[model samples]
Target chain A: MLLSPSRLRGLGSRVPPCSSFRPFTAAAAAAASPTSKPQVYLSRSRNPYLNLSVEHHLLQTTPPDSTVLFLYTNRPCVVIGRNQNPWLEVNLPLLSSLTARTKPGDHEPAPTTIDLVRRRSGGGTVFHDPGNVNYSVICPPESFDRDKHAEMVVRALRGLGVPGARVNARHDIVVDVDVDVDVSESDGNHGANTFKISGSAYKLTRLRSLHHGTCLLSSPNLGSIGPLLRSPAEPFIKARGVESVRSPVRNVGVGNGEFEDAVVAEFAKMYGDPDVFCEVGDEAGAVDGVEKGMKELLSRDWIYGQTPLFSFSTYPTEDDPRERPSLPSDFHLSFEARHGQLSKFTFVNASSAGHVDIPSSSSSSPLDGSRIYDVEDWTDALRSYGGTVNSQAETAGRWLNGLFGTGHAKTQLR
Target chain B: MASIARCVRAARPSVLSTISKPIAATSRPVFYRPTQRCFSATPISEVRKYTKDHEWIDLHADNKTAVIGISEYAAEALGDVVYVELPEEGATVAQGDSIGAVESVKSASDINAPVSLRIVQSNVELEEKPAKINRVPEDDAAGGGWLARVEVDEQGLKEFEGLLDLEAYKEFTATLHE
Candidate 1:
């Protein structure tokens, strides 16, 4: 099952075969072999797509009974759960504008453009940057316990002098910090001291169970996380998938190297010294399976089209009846999306235009079979209705385009 | 297939006695629909088999239909399922292929097919009430926890024959805990 040297050389022509490529490929092959000893890996690449694909490859190809530990850091990204709705969980408008914004009062330039990713694991959305380190453990299903790895990370934190670190009931690692606040306003109602430092999620197959978590160490973008995760369309869309439970989060105040070393030490205590410990990165994309998985992860279909069924109503309905935020126009519009395709759209009240049954993917109309992410201009989509854009249509289209991050005019955050 | 069906029927009472409740103990009613040539044959029976992966399939007497679902053991282990992503109806799959997945406790676990099948219908109601799977995972009744109804081919039947019986499955799970 291991990638042959000849094949690795063929796939990785971009990487010099006589140099570090040999060790990387050897480590990967060792990790992939069923009979090989337990493995540990550290990724030097900051590409979120590559990191996830590499992790997934390890999850699939690693020995069924053997345990694996992978540690890596992504540049900056917003990663959503496999079944979560991007439009409901993420603020698309703000996310699209992040490249132009910098930390408040910081002299350093803004970080690179944030990449949006949809991970195969199921959980709420999370923000990742260089200050955050992600640790993944893949082990046999019989040995899988949700809190096992989280507790290990807590032990690592405690070793690093973070005395308040502990695993919460929800299987996340949190740190208690003294704060002057009312007990009712704090998360988990455990007074105001509890703040999550690591969020855990899992992917389970028949043979292997993979537990991965993000530990916020010293992220400068903590200020932007709250706004980035809060979508303007949250009040309007009633989604049919896992919704995130908001938690107060903070950094554990440790360097990435220090944290990684401590975690590896703790892992060694649990499972003996790794047989192979090496670095992997962009060269991993050279492997055929990894390349394929990377392509799938980077695909538009998996990112947007994999979203579960959801409905959007301008006014409160039976299923999602919360007082909706006020809008510029009083146009009562409703729609439903299945797999990110606009399946149904209705103009319940369009000012003078009584009720108009617009065409969705399920019916015949200008917006037939349109993928929500592909529609860059909602006004253009609505213009085909009645051959002219009315006031109500214009107002709704502009608002929706903004909410869905497809607006023609990108507002510079600078 | 007949021997397996008989074994399942003979073991039904013990199977009911083994599992802890609030697990609905009522077995799905297997009606005897006469085949074109076997009009005088006794009531047709369905055979239920369990996979080591913790899925169960109730193979119809016709040998060409089956209802698939996760076992009660799996449902209890996966606390509070928030969403069930059902497979695409009519998609042909091999025995070990991942047909769909369930999201529970911040984890998404693949639900593999117990046998080769062409999906006919999925339990769409699970999309809205995912907790039903936890409440009655082995129930195949209407509005129950069954994941799909699929068309089983000869290969599928062969695979189904190899799966563990309820008694054997109970023993297998017992060993895992030990």
Candidate 2:
């Protein structure tokens, strides 16, 4: 039933669209309004095999206030934020593994291709497939409040009877279950408090706007998704090991179809307000926009040009010296200075027989008088008596004298 | 792959077992969609020349230099550009060669050189913070946000004649309306 704004205004009382209100439009008043609705548009289709041409057409041409609900059913696919680099966000090997699973005779039309699609928003990477429903709320900038709109959608789902269904701060609709319960209550709390779900992003043009996301109604192929969407390398920390990074809560599809239908119906009702909904297929303008965007998305420079250069530093360890020793007396010393402060010192000795003594009071020996020997004279004497001096004595003396150094003493006894 | 699908299919029964009942007993009515419009107006000026890519160049009366940026329609189409990569000063670029890139949250597009020219200055603020591009796409030295300035070549001046005039581009874009 059409609920024109002018007609709704005439109804006098400001009844919310969710209420069982009468159609205020004159045309609607004359026609019999059906109470039960069929064929609820969930959002735009999230089909991987969705024609890019059609997708572009719809986006460029669709008028504002058009709500398109799509059910994405197919193999797993990676959808990147409009401005993100696929190489930076995705694990190449994992993607390759998922791609390998595709055989020549997979299906007649072939399941939606899973490589990468640059969406028109600034969110993070999300895995999509048939089990998930992708929803797009295209509206005017004034009508779309990111937080409020997401909350409204969540409220609609809760209204549909999904127990404990609440919109997280990140704009994701979440429910609690007790299977393995791998998802930490801590994480759920963080999501509720932090307002982040898998990651919701948006794009608003002058005339057309869209905020789209995946509602994982069913448990996706975790084996494929987990392996494919693994996080990129991170700093080595025990708590955030690769295994921890890979763990994620499976989608709700692992539950029942009746429940899924109820959730889907609720979302459809929330998105399908006759006052807010405009039904239109792919049009020319959106197609042109998509074509332009696709051209840019597929461009070599656009795809790979802005990558940040990465560099790492490597320093030689004492165990792996820069140069191998050729003679028994050969030795090397390395020192590090930072901000004019002596930070570290390392020494390597390749002596075969003679005791290498670093005597205290080398000043008295007429050797380099300024040289501070770490070893005391008595300790050096004792070490010298041993066929070859391998000094724990020198190390201990260095500690006592506060001449901080790290070194390896190599010697062969005669 | 099929086995994985079967696993998901098998788990479906268990997934529904855990979902709580709907919060509200009564179903809510549906929501209404909104009407959207596209920005298609083209600027009007004899001195202003437009690129097929939608960038416009306004040649200064001095004839030696010109200010260049995406057309108003192009900017609107790109949404809020968060970052802009500008060409380096002293670098010579050919007409139509990509000089830099502009990134919005949902999209990224290359900024092609409208004329064969030598870059004299680049907007440094964009390097440190990219959101300035979205805030002001045409602010020159006065605003501290103009993308770049370039010394135009003789051939570039000749090529300018072939570009779309204001009225022609406006009409061209208007045809795209639904």
Question: Which stretches of model 2 miss by more than 4 angstroms?
Answer: A1-53, A64-71, A99-114, A169-198, A223-227, A230-250, A254-414, B1-82, B85-128, B131-139, B148-178
| Per-residue C-alpha lDDT of model 1 across residues B100-135, encoded as one tens digit per residue | 999988888889999999999999999889999888
> Total clashing residue pairs per candidate?
0, 45
For model 1 the interface RMSD, in Å, equals 9.6
DockQ of each: 0.34, 0.07
DockQ of 1: 0.34
Scanning candidate 2 chain A in windows of ten residues, the lowest lDDT window is: A405-414
Please, what is the TM-score per model? 0.86, 0.44
Candidate no. 2 TM-score: 0.44
lDDT of 2 by residue, A1-414 (tens): 433334433332343231211211211332243332222222232334233333433434444335433222334566665445443455543453344223222343334335555554555667765555555544444444455445644654454454455666445555655445444422233333221223345654434445665666553343456545543321110110001122243454322333334434444455444322222222211334444655555543333332322111112243333432232234323322211122223233434212553222232322121112122242342244232234443542332222211110100000
lDDT, candidate 2, B62-135, per-residue tens: 45676666654554445556656577678888887767666553333557777777777777667555655545
Candidate 1 residue-wise lDDT at B137: 85
